[model samples]
Target: MDLRAGLSQQQSLKLSMTQELSQAIALLQYSAIELVDFLENKALENPLLHIKSRKAEVYQPKAKGQSQKSNDKAWIEQISDQRFTLADHLFPQIQDMKMSPFQKRVVTHYIYHLDDNGYFTGNLQDIANHFNFSLADAEECLAILQRVEPAGIGARTLRECLLLQLNRQEVKNELAERIVSEHFSMFAEKKWKQLSKLLSIDIKEIQQVFDYILTLNPKPGAAFHYERASYVIPDVMVVQEGDQFVVRLFDHILPKIQFNKDYFASLNSYQDKKVNDFLNEKQQDYHWIIRSLEQRQKTILNVTGKIVDKQQAYFEKGPTFLKPMTMKEISEELGIHESTVSRAVREKYVQTPFGTVELKSFFTNAIESVSDESLSSSKVKMAMEKLIKEENKQKPLSDLDIVQLLKENDGIVVSRRTVAKYRDQLGIPSSSKRKRYD
Candidate 1:
């Protein structure tokens, strides 16, 4: 029972993170776009930071008819085409509907509750209570909302969404409607045997009905929210020269940052200690940030260079040649932590001879081959995809059949369950679902 406190000397190893180290870690994780945005913000905050602008050389055509003004006008028109959002598409239709003020208000509230997928998320009872309206009125308003341009705009569930679309078909499909309404769970699960027995319909007819159901738009509002196609901006470009691949970074894509020399020089003349201290602190921050940026670029280049070197077979041949690799392996080789390697590759893209690919895509789990050598899971998946593509639609290959095919052709040894898992990962339907009666 030692109740008295006594001072004792002890030695222990302690790890601490400095502000600059923390900043470096954070900067390393930032994607190219994010890094640019961060630097822009920092430039605004630090008066001593300046971003150098690299102006592109504009070419003027000396031809007879072409004019710079016309090009400028065309460019303006291209960007000016407004994107129609789901709300924008539906609001105008709502205004055109002839409804009493109270009804319109209730309908608008319901519309607000509709999610991006055009499914109602709010409780009808809660909405009715909030609006001081009867449940009957709310239901009527809901029906009216559903009748808008998109057939399944206000559905509560997937079944309801499909049923709404089914009801709008030119040819009445009573069987499809019944399947959607009553046996939706069974239909979704693809229990063709049970469905055929229950409905007293042949498997062929059931297939036809299922095929028709597939044509219906599950997310009706998705069409209205037009998404502009985004193009990938590769952070690194690999160019093949003789026997070696030269790695080039898209440094020009990022803003060139430099210290504001004139501003720094002006600060030296300041008499106030506080002013000098503030400038000095800001200068240190500016320098540290610059060094971090440089380090980030260097790390990315080094990591990507190693990846390119290792995945040379993939670059020379195709995706099928991609070897199994992990972050741990790269981290060990580079003498860095696994997390650091992960950060370096995250959201990064590399432009190769084949195409621009995500850096993360290069790393995949290894599958054991017949020769006891490890094979990339991606390569196996690619092989599986090829087999499925060439498969007879009438008799789609089962997971067991795929495993056999891989063993015979590719000399790969994988379980049926693994094949099934890979197929699922590839978004391929089961054999029963994929089978065609024709």
Candidate 2:
């Protein structure tokens, strides 16, 4: 109960993280590309470090009908003609339309405001103010822009986008137009029973109309973008080797870093203590970085190897077989801290037989089945998708029906609510929306 401060010798053991250790921990989280960039920068800064550049393997083209020069010429021509973009697509159409110069200017301004999805994201009032024109004039320009090939273009809301498309159809869908205009909230929420009562139409008919709505392009400008397809570079590759899967780190892709022996040897003969101390500090930093990088690689290999082992079924049978896994489970199995496992997998990609997938995607929450076996949420989602795809269109299954089907067929007993959650996750609508009238 004594509160007075007293001088006393105390003995205790505590762990403290050094700056080098902190840097090592941070390096573990960096992706393959990031690590390469980091090493390249470090090599430039440190005089004692040298990164060996990979020798470009000379391409030995096989004897074919066309020469390599001809192939190069054709590739150059192909790239030159591939500069078409959303703006390029719309500008020609704008040029063809017969309008006053002022009208054309207004239309062009509206076009500039259109988002990647072809929706007009800017305020009409803002456009009006910029042009020093009435809001009505801006609206008129937007209306004319909506008349472009993509009917949903220049729409502010999803309701407007659908209605615009429906209006432009040669044979208009009156039911879809009404649903989008009036019951958009209900349509979005998939309140099929309420919609049925409100429209006084059969649930089946509403679903048929919904199916038509699905056919219309939601993101009209997505395909017209000039953006090149991005490719993922996987840090690790998992190859099936007979009964076991082999996890190999892509070390060849990264530049090999080593100490410059000549530079290190020359630094030892320097007379200036300050300069020598600075060089020594740099050398120590270089050594720590190299060690950290090696440790990072080992941690990654161990974590990914364990992950591949746990998700072996996923590699063999596809995404449906993705078993329930967690960082804690992996940490316990690998004899590492949960945070260490997390950092090792963060922003990392692993190339499998199927495709390149993020390492973090391997860990998913478990859902208990009736058989007392755990199912990954991803697995349940796949099961839900399969059921929806194979269900009778004329009488689409409800969430409750899916719950029962999973229990009966897959031996997975999930709640109706859980089925609904999984269904939503798959971007699937309700039973009423999925039903086919004809």
Candidate 3:
């Protein structure tokens, strides 16, 4: 072998990520609202681009009698939020109470220190040092805070929270009080046999106590800090026309773009070199953006149409008929990259005959079965949920029992661990926790 400094010629092919190409990729991934926002921002930079607003539909309210006016909002809905937090709700109650100024100040301090779960997280020693009061006085202030309307507000632990709620009951449950007071650890851990032996009471009574405890609020302040409801706007809709389903973009919700022809033509014919170059650059940018947006819409429509075609059974019969399909399979069928398909479906939704469903839900991993075609994990979960719903509460099915039942009833083969995982995903408890003695 000889080593020498020389230039070698090689022929190779590689994709160059030009600026316009990158923009096209980003446009494909953005949701409908995000695309509108992006275009609005770009219009400020490009003088040749202009965005046209679509007409919005307003819902009109029906006429009501004078007596019913108080029960109904007139026509418009409130958009501004003035939600109150836990601290705001508690401050006024103690402000008007008959208590010493220092005591009210201490309670106010603790109220501001309570966590979202209504737990008083401040240490007694810390409160005493801050307020120049004894630890016992601090504790008394905390007790007052706990005795407010939301019974469990200042509790430091779940056991204490339960006890606080129980104390406020009109007719107290003595057994429940004792269990939560003493054997809370055992009861929560579901050591029913040990609890039965230790308390010298029927396990059935323990079951009753468990049911009663579920009725209490664990996070008492959570209601005051509740989140506002969020609404989802779908990007596309699949409608059945005759026997074929057609995919249509929600064009009404989209912001349309029109070229500023007069603005561009006026700026043109300037003799100065810099002004001509600037106008030319802006026009190119505007055209690139328009093309990118067109490509984005076309890609999304093609991807969604393919998904609707493949998931025809699901559209016709419902989610129970969703087959095992993957993004790779869709990419192959459409002759596009897997990442492109993934980006097209990311955070995107389509309205169908069933309802507005997320695009990602149509792609589920395959679950093993004896049949030639495997079942989707979603379908198997549906079957598992059905079995659990009709299960005998006296001996709720264990993970192994669920596995056997799935194979016997649904012809789906999965391991015990998989069944346990699916059960946890469904938010169902284990056999011991789900058992009922009544």
Candidate ranking (lDDT, best to worst)? 3, 1, 2
Q: Report the C-alpha lDDT of model 3 over 78-143, residue by residue, as the tens digit.
A: 556778888878888897777798999899888878888899899999889988989999889988
Which tens-of-lDDT digit does each residue in 333-422 have in candidate 2? Answer: 989999999899888889899899999999999887878779998878888889989999878999989999888988887898888887
Indicate the TM-score of model 1. 0.87
Query: Mind giving the per-residue lDDT tens digits that candidate 1 earns over 62-119?
Result: 5687786777765554455587778888888989999988888788878788888888
Q: Rate the local accuracy (lDDT) of all candidates.
A: 0.87, 0.85, 0.89
TM-score of each: 0.87, 0.85, 0.88
**Candidate topping lDDT:** 3
Deviation in angstroms for 109 in model 1?
Answer: 3.8
Cα RMSD (Å) per model?
Answer: 3.4, 3.5, 3.5
- By TM-score, rank the candidates, best first: 3, 1, 2
Superior candidate under lDDT, 1 versus 3: 3
Error of 2 at 253 (Å): 2.3
Candidate 3 wrong stretches, greater than 4 Å: 59-73, 76-89, 112-137
Which residue pairs does candidate 1 place in steric collision?
none
